[model samples]
Target chain A: MALNTQPNLFEPGKRYFRAFSPGDDFYEALIETHRDLSDEQSEMVNARLILLLANHIGDIAVLREAMSIARAGVVAKD
Target chain B: MLSTYQYPKFEYVRPPEIAEGRDGHYPVVIVGAGPVGLCTAIDLARQGRQVLLLDNDDTVSIGSRGVCYAKRTLEVLDRLGCGEEMVQKGVSWNVGRTFFREDEVFNFNLCPEPDHHRPGMINLQQYYLEDYLVQRARKLPNLEMRFRNNVIAVTPGEKQASLRVETPDGAYTLTTDWLVVADGARSPIRTMLGLDIEGKVFMDRFLIADVVMKADFPTERWFWFDPPFHPNQSVLLHRQADNVFRIDFQLGWQADPEQEKKPENVIPRIQAMIGDDREFELEWVSVYTFQCRRMNRFNHGRVLFVGDSAHQVSPFGARGANSGIQDADNLVWKLALVMDGKAPATLLDTYGDERGFAADENIMNSTRSTDFITPKSRTSRTFRNAVLGLAEHHPFARALVNSGRLSVPSFLVDSRLNTADDAVFAGNMVPGAPMDDAPIESVGGEPWLLQVLGDRFQLLHYVADAADLDAASVAALQSLAEGPIPVEPIVVAARGRAPAGLRTLIDAKGRIRERYDLQPGTTYLARPDQHVAARWRALDPARVRAAVARATCNA
Candidate 1:
């Protein structure tokens, strides 16, 4: 046990993580994934969604790589 | 031809070329033989069920994915025989550092290596952990590993789930009684199913650089506020093993990733912070953005999501992989029992409720961690700087840096899972409250459980024994301890005159008075899965039995 300290967001301790919560885009996905959009819109939305998430995790390059990975995926499959 | 899908972590290919049998039919087909998926296979195969695990790529990933292994995940892997391998291969990290300007300090160990078990976190690459798991999956008589096979679609129905795999020769369909989607965040299965994922996006971006430096940088972690040392941003550094350093520097949300890729971006950041500080060569540099979102439901009929596919959290505190693995540990056993008909399908619902709570809490935690570290608002910057300023002169002021708030806990669902009866335990774990930890009889290790078992599903500890237990009370313990499932006993006697095998618990002199609130001639009952269910004094056998009977009826 260590000395008690005031609670801090950056402080060392156990905390929880949730990617999607109420009113989050995950909730939006329930509405979005259910609706129709153009391939371009969906693609941009998808790209934004991926980038949005990638950025949140603290790495944009990997996310860009993830995009490249996804794009390469289309080519590889072809 | 099967539809080929791409995920953030790996590419999915179908009809994996590696394993194709003329009549290759698998009862259970697991896609992406990552740690969680493989562990799921091991759990199913353990019950004499043959399983086929498919990987889209030719081999296991040779990179880092989830480097942090939690205690629960270790226990689950231990059950699958890879526990030792993981423990041996990974470096255990317990201490964490928080930097407020030049004033640096190490907080308490994030996770500890107790005298008996492993420590807080294991900083091993994702691929290494998966390799050990894949090897263990191979040894199982009923397990098969298929590579280069991509699963195109996941269709789940009331009775079964099917996967369309595009193999080398041709596309084939695999039908399994159940499906566990351990695919990474960009989960095709999740997309195909159209499950709702919700969360906010932080505008910050950082680079994850894996480097091998010859010199020591304090096996301790370092957090930088006036980051990049010179460029002026936030930086976080972690040392996992000898010569291995994981550094993260916030990229201000709009920095050109390509520009940073120029070896030019590297020196400035390093020089500013370390000032040509020592020799270190970068092995891998990847840019990433994090999202905190979770599938509204972990299970949509037979298809279930674990790991990033189920949810995602910002990488603060190494919570992403650690929690994902815990999701696996929590889901597998309950799924196993349901699959084996040992329990009903409702048992699976516990998986979502328990882990979902963990997920929600994690999102909140990582979000706070992010907010505190970044100067998103002027007020936040001032508040952060004030704390940093205080921390420099007042060691106690550094409490802001030492707070352990990010250790998101998925404490079991309150009801019967908790067995301590302090009324306070209508919530989480507290010692001396009729809880139980199980030690597997045939298995090599101890599996602790805190429980007051039987039909009542009670948690009894601060109560009397059966012999001296008042008649009605004896009937209650029996009903709780023997009925629906066995409540394994873990005896904790009063300190001074405890029995030989029993551990010393509450002392007659009231050593545990602050916590357990001990008293003489009283017994307590905890629920199954270990949390206090009820406490009693002087067994009124009929009343006790009646209470036991009532709980069973409700459960």
Candidate 2:
């Protein structure tokens, strides 16, 4: 099966890591989403982003799944 | 005549030493045979998972590290089924008094909480408490407590953890499904993981003197702030259950640490707390700096941090070890469920969220307590004395008395903060929640919940039928269990019909009040670790489904 075609896994990366990262196109979109969250909520999201990224880098198995989730999520959006 | 309470003999069948490849692997390997690590192993083993417990110490216990255990920690131990022995051997004292100078004294009674199951505090030497935990850990069939083995390093991954152990026999590598670091505050595993601990390192050091003294001290804790005998110093005198006493003196930054064991200096400091009028012998005297700090993140890959590794508060509240134990209690079941394919991944995140919040709260409390008693400047010292002075005459100081005396009440990790409401019970700890005393009969001795009004750890049997839950929500709860809960985060089942299907858990007295807090006619799904996963007004099928889903998915 294609990487993104796995079952039960949700689409990933609809959310950005921070307020603005260099060369990121979703800065405006994330800013709009930021309006929905309080300061604590935004910080919670940031913390979750760090953990998810750590999971991807820490373990190969997690990285494969994360890649799949990212591919499938972006594919679905496109 | 023999001392009836003798330590048991260990003569177990030894396994042949085999090479690493052929042996079937364990899911997690815990280093340190301390109470926190041992109990964490037991909690996992009870869930039918395999664990390898490693400790560098040849035998159990090192020193009397933490003695003042709060009610919340006792409740967690009770869930682990060791509370009976803990309570029997330990001392329970609930009143705390602050002595200003020599004359003015104010006391705060920590006993009168609204709950009936537990009072505020218990006292046992740290060694005795860890001894009971090590005994319980040894009994688990899936648990292997490897003594004299120290954790050299930990490498965390998505599905498993790699550990290096330095043993007298030799060095060995271990692999497991998860890594839980319970090694003390200077945790080697934590440092390797690069977890940042952020907080002010208080320059204020203290003298912790555990001595056997005969004096006129009350059966409570007494603190002296800026007293004449030791002018511009702080004194913490706790009367432990027996003749033993814990005396801590706030030392200035310039004080020499070597003075504690100098033989010339130890006795004079001991005489300061208990006056020279009495005879006493010093057991252990250590002068150290009490730094207040906590890690920015509690998890590094498959590794989960609990107890001191995750956070360390000042000894002011006796909260550091107790809160870390709560972290262990909260994380184990969720990890078990996910590892066992019972719950979702989001549940693991709640471990960090809930526990980090707890550590943050405890840090705030410990810092406040430290500031109030051990002021930094002349003006701050005057303010602290003023507040403590009013404790007797004013109602506000009385409230300050409860601040450090009580623990942070246990509540669900994701539960929204309760805004001010007249009829609401406000705390992370919910009311009439299912407790850890799962009756012996259910799930073959695994931890289960006894509903406030329901029978012991009984499953929902059939909510209109056995599989009434919708697909979307069922999947959510299954994936996000923060810890071990009876309802399976999906559907905690029972052996029998239950007739009414849902029943209440009755205490020894058979009355229905929440051990933490109480609310009538409420159905709460308690985490296997015994914090409420989610709660509702009625046992409405849809609401139950929604709550389970909310708990599981963060929806």
Find the candidate with the highest lDDT and give its number.
2
lDDT of 2 by residue, B204-257 (tens): 777777777667776676767767767877777776545667777888888888
List runs of model 2 lying over 4 Å from the truth: A1-78, B1-24, B214-216, B401-406, B410-521
lDDT string, candidate 1, B1-555, tens digits: 111111233334434333454333455567767777777777677657777777777655554445566655665565566777787767766676776556664355654323324455567767677767766776788887767677888778798887787766677777787778887888887888888888878887877776666665666666777743634567877665445667777887887777775556865676566557587767667677788888888876677788788888888756777677667666665666566665677767767777787788677667666766765654345445655655654444455542224343454534343333433322123422322223212112332221112212333344322223344433444444454343433333333322322222322232222234544445555433233444554334344444443323323
Alpha carbon lDDT of each predicted model:
0.57, 0.60
Listed per model, the TM-scores of chain A against the true chain A are 0.38, 0.37
- The 10-residue segment with the lowest total lDDT in model 1 chain B: B1-10
- Model 1 in CAPRI terms: which quality? incorrect
Give residue A13's error in model 2 in angstroms.
35
